[model samples]
Target: MTFSDDLIKLKQNRSAQEPLPSGIAPYTCSAFFKSREYGMKPKARRWDHLLSKESHNLKPSPLKTASRASGQKKLISLGTARPAPEYFPWESLSLRCLQDTVTEQAQPAPTVSMASVKLEQPYDLGVAMNYGFSGGSPQALRFVTEHIEIIHKPPYDDWECSLTCGTTSAIEIAFRIFCNPGDTILTENYPYSGAMTCAHAQSLHILGIEMDDLGLHPDDLDHKLRTWDYTKGPKPSVLYMVPTGQNPTSTTQNLIRRKQIYAIAERHDLYILEDDPYYFLQLGKSKQALASAQLDRTDANEEFFKCLSPSYLSLDVSGRVLRMDTTSKILAPGLRCGWVTGSSQVIQKLVSYYEIGVLCPSGPSQVMLYKLLDETWGHDGLFNWLRSLSLQYRCRRDNLLESCERFLPSDFCEWNIPAEGMFLWIKVNISGYRQTHTASHGDGNVARYLAVEDRIYQKAHDNGVLVSKGSWFIADVQTLKGVNFRLTFAAAPVGELDEALQRFARALETEVR
Candidate 1:
């Protein structure tokens, strides 16, 4: 049959079949399932000019191309060397998961399983355990795609999703795609340490933009971009940030701030790498409000989504935002599974990178996630779980906040109540320490401040408390001015939070005295 004839027949078959229930699509890549019913939103503006020299040199893998051809109906694949599924040791896998709803009493967790014999199922171990496409197994990709649509629906058309190993890997891949060695990149003054290390390894220059409690300062970002210095390197074309509950700082950008930053990106023609792992941990404006509010299971999902700060992807009209999300924080970190959403062209490039690099995310992880998210907890169930999870985190945050209030000396330390995420950023009054322990040389003032920070950190450790020094997270050492520390309320038991803070307070008291 001619290609047009095949297309017509396929359309006829689709029309003849019963339609899927609302919001449900057949197992396929998100690109194939994107809704076009919104009356022709404009396609993402072309970003080919932003590609790095290395990305431009990447070509499609010959083996992957051949594998695509092998998918044709009734085609015999004598050329490929893939092992048969029978050789796989595993027959079936089962997982025990807590019920989506919170309960006053303990109950037996539900079990979900996937078996090789379940060929009739949309996804099973047989297909998932073997070699697969670089983007990911269709089942997992579909789930993330649908989740993204329901949550942050990008404003532009032709956006796509691709499964990733995790956000860390995604960051590295992004850097490779858009930046060359020695290229400058912009990020918050206090950025995630891991990301800083990743950029450093690539020999990329990082310019730290000043920030406040609301997160990255839009004025600082715009001023830095406006006053570009080519002698340092090509003007940065990328901005990396953690918009929601930013790491080390625990600052969540409000809607107005997000809009201002997006405007700056548009003005400067820069791509935004929104690394938002803490996006779902939004705890609201006040702890008391979160504590008092009762969750209505019927409308909890709607309420939860409404409370969230809009993502940069939602504001993206030109598809310059590449948002990375991971299952690490929301789920288990060891799963090492996540996904990136961006323009179709950008996603295609990431997929190509996957084919030549990791090949694909772990098959077992993808299949297990598929069974958990797609089979066990449907979209509503997952949202219900997320709501419950947020409440649990809020309780933990409250415990830590209460502890801080009771233990930390008001005269020496202060902090802003974190609106989201697992951390509390505390600013220490270091004026006394600096005055008493002045640097021998005038130029050593910053060095002297760092020494005092180290002294305080050591005192805290000796007093049996652990806290992260803010200096370790500084994107630019030259920007370091004050003494700060990060403390996490996510891992400790509620009862112990107070004791930990008390120890930290005692240590601070001794050091300042």
Candidate 2:
């Protein structure tokens, strides 16, 4: 059936008591319904009159009117109600604006220092690195595909793949091909920021699924599918998740959980974007060891084996899964090399985006990664290096957690012992305080957790410590309901981690106290 017809059927089915889903309200119109009924746009004047009549007839119930009479007040106009400019800090804004104005002009200036250096790889000589293949360099595509095969263990014959600059681009391309603006999409409650940004930019409707410790709850997903606006027909066409080491929550599901999640997707006939960057960074060590070694990076703890977990892509069937993997954490983030593995049709669509867009992923970056892979950890050596890397991170995670334990009050912050990846998602407990003073976030707005990014950055520069705020990974999403932080222990030295954690603990304590 046509979308218009489906929308009418959906509206006719909707109860008056139910509020329209936030993103689905734009398409509801009598003309839209008529367009569906007759397969054409209705006369604008006729539709407008009908809409006007409907709007005029709608009225607040007597109880609602009476309640308003008792206590309701008109919304204060922003122009009149807002505090004067002098009442707020104007200097900070002026200084920041001046800095931005200065920085913008400073970038275009020609530097004399440029003349001192000879090009190791000249850009003007019709460089071999001008661009790679339309999809990506043959070597890069091969490297990415091979990496997926090694990491996900999907049947090499069953899966087709392509290289994108990063997971965000891959997702954006896939989104363009699969959904138009206003198309309904499903995602985990706390999703990766990149995916949401791409979806929002495309004007897609985002439906977030509730999450538990096991990740997206299967029951909640199943319920959403069964009870969704079927009159509109199929509320969501896609499901996106980062099942392992989720960005803001750091929750990972086990094989059983994966099976349930996949089952829900299959039952609902929804496509899955299994974005798993932290898949390899999971620590499989024991909890006791995790607690004791929270600040250590050396593989000293024997208990680390218990923390290892599998990924969602490993369990995918029905060809519905689009696996996006990246080399940012294990290798350098500067490479910006990531790949998508899925059906051949999907890969072709992604390739179309690559061809028309910037052509493909960087050639030098791809080759650099390939060389780093071969030289540092040839073939399956990549796996070995990853294992060693995970072991190293496990100790760092233990240290961060231990530091939290030592420094903060027991009730001040809550965090999961990270199994994989560089970040520890921390939720600050603000029960005792009237106002939580979080200075780490980019903005000092009390509406969200202070990201603590600047504070961590300054600490890294001044005291030799580094960490990331949880706010960076938060998409402009309603599902991220509370204050949380994402801390990275990957870069900081082992000795410095203890000091850093201590500093972090002090910071958190100071915020509340």
Compare the candidates by lDDT and give the number of the best one: 1
Model 1, 1-513: lDDT tens per residue?
Answer: 232333344344435543321111112356654444333788898878889998999987877776663334456667656777667788888877667655455354667767865344445666777777888876787678767876787888788899999999999999989999999989999999888988999999999999998999999999999999889889999999999999989998999999999999999999999999999886766878676556664556767777888899999999999999999988888989999999988988898898899988888899778777877876777777778788888888888889899989889799998888889999988776746654455465577768778888999999888999999999987778988999999887778898999999988888875
Q: Which ten residues in a row have the lowest lDDT in candidate 2?
A: 93-102
Per-structure clash totals for the candidates: 0, 33
**Candidate topping TM-score:** 1
lDDT of model 1 at position 163 = 91
For model 2, residues 73-179, the per-residue Cα lDDT tens digits are: 34332322223323332222000111101111323222111110122322111221433444554434444554454345453234566767888777887777667
Which residue runs does candidate 2 get wrong by more than 4 Å? 1-130, 155-158, 230-234, 285-310, 374-376, 435-481
The TM-scores of all predictions, comma-separated, are 0.92, 0.64
